[model samples]
Target: MLHLRAVCPPEQTDQAIELLRAHAGTAHLIVHRGAAVAPEGDLIEVDLAREAADEVVDSLCALRLDRTGGITLEALDTALSDAADAAEEAAPGEGADAVVWQELLGRTGEESRWNATFQAFLVIACLLAAVGVITDSPVTVVGAMVVGPEFGPLAALAVGAVLRRWDLLRQAAAALAVGFPVAMVFTGAIVLLGDAVGVFDTAAIVGNHEVDFVYQVGEASFVVALLAGAAGMLAMTSAKSAALVGVFISVTTVPAAGYAMVAAVAGSWDRAGYSILQLFVNLVGIVLAAAIVLILRRRKQRSGDLLRPLSRG
Candidate 1:
């Protein structure tokens, strides 16, 4: 369920109230006239199911409430009232599977930005991957994957493709276009510094078959990437963020990039080519899987049969 808070002008208040009343999914509607000081309008609050949230928000936006007033929707984590139950029952689909397109747009838009913290995590993760490749340590590789923040932009890119949002596509593209090269260059420089300090040597980087998995491209890598991509889409669309960690570890994106950087630094064009190919395969698989999921989900939502309530089970 979702908790919606709205501020509406005096003239629009009645129409807004009527809209809520007409929808069986809304409950416990409350109104306070002339209560808002900033926009100076009536304050209205209601609880509605996730399945109905998109339509309601769109209808409200049609009134230009988002421009003149405000409309906010938040998850109703623990709705103790029976009215909440009735609201969910009245809605078309289950909360978990509902798309809530507006929320998704807002989330992806914010996450796709190429901000300072994003670059820091990207660089640090790549550096860690470089260390893992040089030391032949799978633990360090996993740690790098966990620390990498690359998934956000990837997911945003998929979301953008689904929604046809050019801004989101542009932001996600820029993040990847700039982020990976920068991380690789920085990791290469770090490798040089480590070699100077006797921390990394050519032999340590060469004979490590254990870490060689990062560069090897084959059917298994593609399969794993596809599964991880689907799981990642689920994590982003639903409230199951715990699965995101699994998505991070399952895909070899960061590790591959790191290994490619190390291979390039050592002037091993063959190994570098393999690593780059692996990275490319994983990236294409993930993006394709995510885009497919989003497209199917959007279709299901449109058909009004996407999410089934727990009670229906």
Candidate 2:
């Protein structure tokens, strides 16, 4: 469920109220007229089911409430009231299964921001992977995967493709295009520095066998990437965030980039080529799989069965 607060103009208040009151999925509707000072409008608040939030928000926007007034939506983590139960029951589908499209757009937009924190995490993660691959340590490789922030832009890429948001596509693409190379270069320089200090050597790349999977790309890599992408996108869309950790650990994206950079630093072109190929294959598989998942989910949301009102039919 979601809590929606709207500051609506006097003229549009009645229409907005009517829209919410008419919807079976809305409950706990309250109106305090002329209560807002900033926008100078009446304050209206309502509880909306996850399955019905998109429809209600769309209708509210159609009334120009978002332009002249304001709308704030927040998820109800603990809705103990019976009204919340009634709202969910009246909605078209289970809350967990609902795909709130605007919410996803907002979330992806936030995650795709290429700020300093993003760069820091990516570089640190790649550096960890480089060490893990050099030392042939599976535990370190897993740690690198856990620490990597690469999934956000990848998920945003899939979202942009599905929504046809060219700006989002470009932003996400830029993040990936610039982020990977930046991380790799930084990791390579660090590896070279370590070699000069005798902390790492060429034998690390040539003799390692335990973490060799980091550089090996094959049918399994694509299949694993496809599965992870599908699961990750689904988790994001449905707000089941706990499932994303599994997706993060399952994909070999960070490990491949880390290994490739380290191998290149050690003058192992063959290994670098294989690792780069692994990275490319994983990326393509994930984007393709995630886009397909979003496309199918949007289709399901548009279907009459899910959109039909529960109260009427």
Candidate 3:
């Protein structure tokens, strides 16, 4: 279930009421006329089922309330009322399968931005992976994998492609285009400095096989990347955050970047090239898999799954 809070202009109050009053999934409705001080309108609230949210929100958007006033939505972890149960039962589809496009676009827009905090986390992850690869530590590589924030933009890219949003596509592209190279340059500089001081060498990279998988790109690497991408997208759309950690650990994006920079510092261009290829493979796999899932989800949501109750019947 979801709680929808909408501020309606005085002129549109009756229309908004007329809309929600007729929806079967509206378990509860409250109207406070002239209560919106800032917006100078009425405050309308509705407890609606998750499956019916997209339909209702679209209707609300059609009224231009999103521009004139505002609408906010929040998911209810638990609803004990019989009215709520009836609303859920009355809705067309399962709550778990609902794909609220507005919510997704909002979330991915934020995630796709290149910010200081995101940069810090990526650089930190790269540094960690650099150390891990040099020491042949799989544990440290996994730690790096968990810390990387690369998936945010990748998922955003997938969303943009499916939704045909050019702005989102550009935002995600700029983030990845600038962010990875910056991090790699920083990592590479650090590695070269460490080598000059006799703190690092090519011997470690050439002989290290324990964490060699970070650089070796093959069929298995692409398959793992695809699986992780699909899982990550499903988790995002369904609001299942716990599954995201597994996605992070399953893909080798961060580790590949680390290996690429570290190998370049050791003057192993061949290995560095391969490491970059590994990174590309993971990224392409994730985007491709996620885009396919989003297409299928949008189709399902737009098909015969939606049901509308007769107005005021």
Candidate 4:
């Protein structure tokens, strides 16, 4: 459900209220009038049904309340007395399935900006991967995976493609274009330093069959990427974020990128190529899968019939 707050000028208040009241779903409405507020008009609070949230939000967007005055919308989770019975009756068919594309797209827009925190995370992730390669510690490798913030941009890319948001697409592509090369270069520098200190040798880095195998592309890599993409989308859209840990582990972005840096430092072009290939495969799979998921989810919502109001007993 959503709780919407709209504060507008005195003249426009009635129009806005009417538009909100006429929204597609059942809504409990409250109105407050105040003069001190800059808007100096009306403040409305609406508790709307969950099933009709998307349509309600769409309608609100159409009203362009922000341009008219000051409008803020917040989703409320508190159960209203009047809504409890209706919720109980509707619970059975309220499957976990919900189209979250719009929400996901909205969130991506909110978080896609390049900031200091993003830069710090990227640097730290690369450094961790470099250390892991030098030490050959799988634990450090996992740490790098957890620390890597590349997923945000990757997710933004998929969301942008699905929504056809050019701004998001540009931002996401820029992040990737700038981030990966920088990380790889930093990792390469660390490898060079480690070699100088006798902490790592070219032969030790390349001879590790396990690391080599990670770089080799196969059908299973595609499957893992696809599954990880779907899981990632679900994690981002749903309230459950713990599921993202599993998705992160399944994707080879950090591992492959780490391996590539190690191979480059060791002057092993074949391994570097393989690692790059793996990275490419995983990226392609995730984007394609996310796009498909969004399309299908939207289709389901469009096809489902809306629930009717219950009669009083």
Number of the predicted model whose TM-score against the real structure is largest:
2
Scanning candidate 1 in windows of ten residues, the lowest lDDT window is 304-313
Q: Write the per-residue lDDT of candidate 2 for residues 1-313, one digit (tens) a residue.
A: 8999999999989988888998889989999999999989999999999888888888899998889999988998888889888888888877888888878888888888788888899999999999998888989999999999888889899999889998898888898888889999999999999988999874667874889999888999999999999999999989697999999899889999999988888889999999999999989998899999999988888894554774423
Clashing residue pairs in candidate 4 are none
Q: List candidate 1 stretches off by more than 4 Å.
A: 305-313
Candidate 4: residue 103 Cα off by (Å): 2.9
Please give, for residues 160-203, the per-residue lDDT of candidate 4 as tens digits.
Answer: 98778989989988877777887788778877887879877755
Tell me the spans in candidate 4 whose CA falls farther than 4 Å from its real position: 18-28, 35-41, 70-95, 100-102, 305-313
- Write one digit per residue (lDDT tens) for candidate 1, span 44-143: 9999887778888988999999988999989877888898898788787677887888888898788878988888899999999988888878999999
lDDT for position 312 in model 2: 21
Candidate 4 C-alpha error for residue 206, in Å:
2.4
Colliding pairs, model 1: none
For candidate 3, give the lDDT.
0.89
Residue 67's lDDT within candidate 1 is 88
Residue 32, candidate 4: Cα error in Å is 2.9
Arrange candidates by TM-score, descending: 2, 3, 1, 4
* Model 1: per-residue Cα lDDT at residue 265: 74
lDDT of each: 0.87, 0.89, 0.89, 0.70
Candidate 1 positional error at 39, Å? 2.5
